[model samples]
Target: MVQDTRELNRTAVLTELLRIRPASRKQLAAASGISAATVTRAVEQLIAQDLVVEAAELVSVQRGRRAVLLDVVADRSLVVGVDLGASNTRVMLADMVGSPIERREIATPIEADATALADWLASVIDEIAGERRDRVESVYIGLPGAVGRDGSTISNAPNLPQLEEPGFLDSVRARSGRPVRADNDANLALLGEQHFGAARNAPTAVMVTIGAGLGAGLSIDGRILRGSHGVIGEFGQLPAGPLGTRLELMVTGPGIMRLASEAGVHLDSPADLFTPDASEPVRSLRAHFDQALLIVLTAATVSCEPEVIVLGGGIAKSLARDLARYEAMLEHHLGAAPRLTASELGDFAGATGAVVAALHEVYRGLGVDERAFGDLPVAVPASA
Candidate 1:
């Protein structure tokens, strides 16, 4: 038990140093709320582990003890984050301090060739981490479907069925040699917003991603609200158009084109379908899209009462053009609505969030309290 307590103190101090950075034992104690003697003992253990190091010193010209500053050994601590979209796969290498070191994106392989995809992903992971590969403690992967709560199985990914194939995920894990983690891509995007983008500090937030498909990710009370069965925030099935048609049928990027095609407009791109001087058919399609979006937005508003709703993915720019108008419409119906906003991380939110989750996992292994992250909305002194 004494050893356990000592380990816990080390985790708190190390976590605080990673966050505030290059701080003295005094500062770590103050920021992390750990006792000064405990912080000192923790620092000693961390330095012995080579996870923490002393760099530079703070001192006055007068006769006084110099304060040696401590920081995480960034190069010695690394993680990988992968955003596996149906069209593109993005990977990032992040240091323990949450700074992204490198990123690479490539066309995602077709669903028929799971082995090929895993091979390419492993090579990319190898290329990005290179000499730093050994330092990577965890690898995070985000997929565009419902990931089980335990993250061992993927039950609802229609586009990338290969992901659920026997031995496919295990192949990536075996090749990478690091523990691989997975979650819904939409959930990772929401995680990105809370950590480093639009939804930062929002107590409750909802994110709607409109790409090849429509998806939602929700955060309540600063915790990712993955539902009981790992099936939550499935916003695409919301009622839209007539009583039967789902919102995803008219609100996704492909769905938008379908709407214009059904209207006989024959538009080449979704952006073209929403011009100010659009033909009547195009206008009608846009109206249908608007109504569909409003339905999803209103549902998010009423159900979660999010502090903010962040729009993301390929179609977010198109939605942002008339965000205020949509906000007004939602207010008219619901009597109140949270602020509507666009994702600040844009296309990289999922990958970035994947890395953040990986870092959190690493911290937990170091004996840091999970509640420290749960209190991210109020407790952590840094952006994290």
Candidate 2:
């Protein structure tokens, strides 16, 4: 039982470290509720495995020597983060710090070839590598559809039907020569925001992404909430509203076009709904947008009263000026409103989250490379 408890303690400490700042053994122990001696042993194992490293020396006021601070070694591994959105595909290469080193984006057709897409991704990865292609360790993709728990199968995505077929991930991995990780797009968006955006410290938050479809991502007590079958937070299925369709129709590209047409305002795409000019059609579109915002706010807040709610995706840009309107609508419905804000990461949150997950995978895969930490100091201060 003690051995099991110690192993559990190690897992807890590692999670806490990833959530917050890197620390020395003593600090990690305090933050993780683990013993310092056990933390020391864990640190040694982590360092030897190249998962952690001596970051720098912490200065001490006492006459004794300073202690070395431990941190996750980011440069030792790399991963590719891909976002397969409804209308576009974004790819980014990042290290463990979640910093992008190389990034690319391209418009995608509703129906695309999986093989061609995989080959395109492989070429993008090669271009990003330039000369040091071997440095890339793995690939991670955020699918707009529901991802199977195995991280291999894509169940269904209306906008991304090309990926519905099997062996897509296999093909990509086979072409790129690296393991692949796949996740729900909204879930990854929340991960990215949790790690690098406005909700970095929030214990509970919700990210609402509106585009071709309306989806949400939730974090409860700093942990991702993936529901049964790993497809939760799907707000698109909400009851059809005044527009004679689901609330998604109010904001999606097709919805925008449909609504605009009904309003007798001809438009090419939903993106045109946000023209800065104040023509009669534009005014009507803005008014329609306000009503749609209320519908979205009611649906999102009534279900889960999160501490913060962030709106993201292509259509979210138009709502930036109307945050107060949405907040008011939510407050009126729920009787209390979570702090509503626009997403800080814009359209790249999903890609960033994919990379973050991939980084963790690479670190876990390369266990205890003895050559990576030869003779490195691994001491920790008692106070911190």
Q: Write the per-residue lDDT of candidate 1 for residues 1-384, one digit (tens) a residue.
A: 998788778777876776677788888999989889888888989989998899876644236766888877877778898998989988888877677888888888775488888887778888889998989998998888887766667766766787776666778888888899888888888988888889988969998898887888988888888865566888786655686787888888788777666666788887776688988878878787888889899888887899999999888777777889999999999899799999988888898888888888887777667876743312121232
lDDT of 2 by residue, 1-384 (tens): 987765566555555555454566767877877888888877776677676788766755347857667777766766788888777888787765555677777776555488887677666666776665677787788888877777677764777777777887778778877777788898888777776676666758888888877778877776677755666776676665764666777777767777788888877667677776768867877787777667766666666668888888878877788788678777777688888888777778888777766765664554322221111112110110
Q: What's the lDDT for candidate 1?
A: 0.81
Candidate 2 C-alpha RMSD relative to the actual structure: 6.5
**Model 1, poorest ten-residue lDDT window?**
375-384
TM-score of 2: 0.79
How many clashing residue pairs appear in each of the predictions shown?
Answer: 0, 1
For every candidate, C-alpha RMSD to the true structure in Å: 3.0, 6.5
Q: Which regions of candidate 1 are displaced past 4 Å?
A: 33-35, 57-66, 374-384
